[model samples]
Target: MEVGQVLHMNAGTGETSYSNNSHLQKKVISMTLPIIEEAMTNLYSSTSPSSLVIADLGCSSGHNSLFVVSELIKIVEKLRQKSGHQSPEIQVLLNDLPGNDFNTMFKSLPSFQKNLSSQLEAKDAGPYFFSGVPGSFYGRLFMKKSLHFLHSSYCLHWLSQVPEQIENNKTNIYIASTSPPNVLKAYYSQFQRDFSTFLKCRAEEMITGGRMVLTFIGRKSEDPTNKEAPNSMWELLAMALNDMVSKGVIREEQMDSFNIPVYTPSLSEVKSELLEEGSFSIDRLEFSEISSSTYYNEYNHSDVSEIAANSIRAVAEPLLVNHFGDGIIEEVICRYKEILLGHISQEIIPGITNLIISVTKK
Candidate 1:
């Protein structure tokens, strides 16, 4: 299936839209702040570009997208102030698949700019330009040696398409406890190919000394079957679909043929790919577990479960609609909430492992 043309979060600022349900992603950006700050500082110190051309690939439309850009600008402005040098003009490119809700994001830009302007009104910051560039990041999206800084958060783990060989991974949309060993191999191979292409594309697009800070969901174990509910949101989603199938709400054929286009790589796998790609040098690589309940402290257990289900629904509903039509959307989400409520226990509220890597163009 052509995943790019169909895959996107639920559009607009509705109840299930990604814009309102992206608290987990927002928390991730907040958690990784120090790493990003360091990466931007290193890039500026090395290149000191007069015009900072920044691109955020897979920058889905939402507050999180603007949050990332604003943080980078703050870092650079601080750097220029410290050095007493002229501030550089900033060019921002927000990229995603063509199906993204760019209209919603674009409409919010005036407010974003207003807030940014007020914050920097008294400070020495350069002109900030914003534009949307819609496309996949697995290939070239910019001219050669054009980007000075790059960032993507919670995006790289999404494969450009599902692994072709996973047809036999029945009754499951992603890697699950019942998935065969071959399923793991297929997913890894797809990740290798996609990630290599991503590295190569960015290497060509970025100038020497350009830096990238990427953070995406991953797993601590090499065994895909060992991933818990927090990391394998798709697995829970598959369970919900299977429940519908049992109730005759969805066909078995639908469940059997579908596979999520995502892979949760181990840290070693990511490092290996970077080393093999041979274009970028790893400056800082780290893995950490953060609670999925980030920013949900005031929410009760039931509220949290619904929010969690909505988050997954926002990301997966488009894929489901493309494959199964819109008939099953509401029922599947309802069932997904039940599944999440059941799986959530009184334990530590399992944290999702995210790998954060900062690399420099060689």
Candidate 2:
């Protein structure tokens, strides 16, 4: 599948839009605030740049996009005040796939800039500029040594594309406990390639001493197919699809051919890739458990199944629509909701494993 052309979160502020369902992402950003602030402080202390260039990779449209930039600016301003140095000009770049909803994000920029301007004015800081760069992060997105800081959340787990050369894996859509060893190897190899490419590209784009803080779905287990790993979510999703196939809504052959281009790497897998690339030095690597109940608490009135289905659809709907016709999208989601509700009702749900890593360019 051409992820660049089809992969994007649901657009607009509708009930099912990613903008509405991204509380989890917001919580993640909040959790990583200390890391982000520390990185910014270190960047400022190490070098006094006339202009600070920051990029938020995979910055899907929402309040969170500007929230990150705003927070970073505050950190820089505070440090500037303490040292009595002139505040550096800020350039914030929001990046995502080509199909991302740049319009929604751009429309909100005026107000965001106004708020940023007011905040900076109170502290005698320089002006803040915002722009959108549309493309994949697996390749170069910026000029050599142009960026000072980089941040990405809930994005790296997505492989550049699905792996090739698998056969007869009809019942699963991801690397699960039931997947063959070859399938597991294929996914891991793909992640190694994609992540190494990511680090290499960023190494060229960012200056030495630059810092990056990234958070994404991952697993604590070294085994990719651990039942408690994030792959379990995909397993549940596949079960929902299989139910549709059993009822004649979608063909079994279609299910067999479908695979999600996402992988949850273990800490060892991530560290290996970082060391192989030989560009970034790991500063911190940690895991946090995000409760499924968080989603439940967000949409208290909505059924658990409905909330889960919408959350998945926000990210996967575009890909699903590309594979299966739009005609079956609603039905597929309905069945998925029902299945997820059943699992949640039985308390069989596995909470998400979030991997937060902070690194600096060597």
Candidate 3:
């Protein structure tokens, strides 16, 4: 599948929309707040730009988008207060793929602006500008030296597209223990290329000494196919698809042809890419574990599988529909939910890792 065109979260404010089902992503953003604060503080301390330009790459439609912007505004306000100067004219850019639900995002802006005005009234912070830039971050999306601080949460793991050569190797939807060496190599090569391009683009867009805080799914193990890492989620998802294939809900060939355009890279992989890119210095890198249960605390239901299925469906349903057609979406999700429910246990479900990295432009 062409990921940039087809890979978007479920749209609108419906039950399965990303806006409704993004608590897990919100948790990730919350975890990275300290890193974000530190980066912005360091940036302001060093340069103290009178007009701070910030961008939130892959900013999906939701409260999380505003949450990031609001936090950065607060940080800048505090910095200005400490320096005894007026807060900078903050320009916030929210970016995502072209197919993102920008309309819904725009609709939410009036309230966001009103709330922001109220919050800044006492501090005398300047009016911040917010706009949506709809496009892929895998390529250039902004003018050179336009951005000061960049933040992306739960986004970088998605590849620009599935590897072209792996069309026939359909044993799984993602890197798995059963995947062959060529399959692993293909995924790694794609990640290396895509991440290098991402860094290069950002380097061109950011001013010298600009800071970035990125958090996404990643693996703790060196092996790409390690079951203890995040690949286990895909393994379970693959099983769900396989069960459907056996029941004739989807073709075996279709299952083989489909693969998720995502990779949970190891810390070493990230460090090596940044080193090779030669435009950024790593300030901090951390890995943390979060339970699947953590994402569903707001829900009244106790079934972990139901929660897990909903979470995955919100992000994966659009892509699945693109590959398997609309008829099979509900059935596939239902089967996947059943499979996950059967496997839910007290072991904290393996293969879920979170990576947080902070860097500065050289």
Q: How many residue pairs clash in each candidate?
A: 0, 0, 2
Query: Which candidate number would show the highest lDDT if scored against the true structure?
Result: 1
Q: Can you give the TM-score per candidate against the true fold?
A: 0.96, 0.96, 0.96
Q: What range of 10 consecutive residues in model 1 has the weakest lDDT sum?
A: 342-351
In candidate 1, residue 145 scores what lDDT?
A: 94
- Candidate 2, 191-305: lDDT as tens digits: 9999999999999999999999999999888888887735766787788788888988889899999999998999888888898889998899888887777646545434667
Error of 3 at 21 (Å): 0.7
Instruction: State residue 176's C-alpha deviation in candidate 2, in Å.
Output: 1.4
Q: In candidate 1, residue 147 scores what lDDT?
A: 92
RMSD of each: 1.6, 1.6, 1.7
Please write out the lDDT profile of model 3 over residues 43-65, one tens digit for every residue: 99999788989999998897777
Candidate 3 error regions (>4 Å): 121-123, 293-302, 346-348
